[model samples]
Target: MADPNWLDERELTAWKQFLSTGAAINRLVDQQLKRDAGLSHQQYEVLARLAEAPEGRLRMTDLAGAAVTSKSGLTYQVGQLEKAGLVRRCGCAGDERGIVAALTEAGWQKLREAAPEHAALVRDLFVDGMSRKDFAAFAAGLAALHDRLNPPAI
Candidate 1:
């Protein structure tokens, strides 16, 4: 009988592939962003999320959540962006204690410059490398995993 505690050969291979592939992709993305825009992957994510938000702004807490980073981490990244003149911090209108991060024109330009190369890299490394059927299945699997990890709040 097979041991329930151990992954079978196929399962082990899949698990190892997932970890190594994800790490490789992350490293490549970080390197590409840093080389092309002088931005780290986390900073790029923050800028992209802000750009997608209404009025190109979001409360710090909301930004942290959207960026999948801790509040402190988001704050530090925002501070760095502020220093670069790419983002600004302002008090939220309705909530005195709420701090909002707004993307500056510079931020928009940076994101614009970074996006094309980023998208092309993603397509080259991930999308074009897989068949449509396989890609769809992989996407579905990832979506399911995401949903499982982040269930809706009551």
Candidate 2:
């Protein structure tokens, strides 16, 4: 009898493809962002998240949640950004202990400069490779997996 715990051939293939494709995409995106924008992928993500928040700022905890990073990891990245003058950290008014990360004008300018080329790279490397129908199905599958892994807090 076959081992029930092992992936079947199709499942194995899909898993391998998912790992390899994700790694390859991450490497390429990281390289491109570093080369063109002088920012790491994580830093860019932080800036983007802050830019989306009210007043271009968010509490550190909320920002960590939005960025899917640990508090320590976010703190490290925020430190780096602060050193570069791309982000500023301030005490939250409502909570003395709470910290907020606010994107500086420099950060906004950096994101604006980086976004167009970043979008083009994404489209070229990933989006353009798949047909619209296939891309939609792929996106739906990923979204379903995300939802399953991160159920809403009731």
Candidate 3:
């Protein structure tokens, strides 16, 4: 078929580069998290989100949103963490139907221990490679793209 509103050479090249670099970055981050924390990147993210909450606890629905994962996927991952004694599920006091996922003491300790190494890896593999000005520009552009793609829920 003939090209119709197809990407020109420059656009195609840029798209390919963006995809390749993004994949590489994802792999590096996941590997670093696994190596330094005995945690997958997703698991680390879940713990970090919980840690930032007021009481290191969030509703399972909120946790799933924060993790940007499906409910079933979040349930499976949280199950693994629960099995590892990294977090526990508690019933929400105000909502009998709601369950909260809270980071366990062991989870906090593991995250604390892995913090430095994780930061170092992120810096060395990603942030350090970008100049401050360029990084800011990239972040702004990414934020715009994300907002455009995902508007807030009504």
Candidate 2 CA-lDDT value: 0.95
Instruction: Give the 10-residue window scoring lowest on summed lDDT in candidate 3.
Output: 119-128
Q: For each candidate, what is the lDDT?
A: 0.95, 0.95, 0.90
Off by over 4 Å in 3: 1-4
lDDT of 2 by residue, 34-107 (tens): 99999998999999999999999999999999998999999999999999999999999989899999999999
Output candidate 2 Cα RMSD: 1.9
Comparing 2 and 3 by lDDT, which wins? 2
Q: What is the lDDT, from 0 to 100, of the residue 20 in candidate 1? A: 98
Would you list the clashing residue pairs of candidate 3? none
Q: Give the TM-score of candidate 2.
A: 0.95
For all candidates, the clash counts are 0, 0, 0
Candidate 1, poorest ten consecutive residues by summed lDDT: 1-10
The digit string of per-residue lDDT tens for model 3 on 2-52 reads 769989899999899999988898799899888778898888888888999
Better of 1 and 3 by TM-score: 1
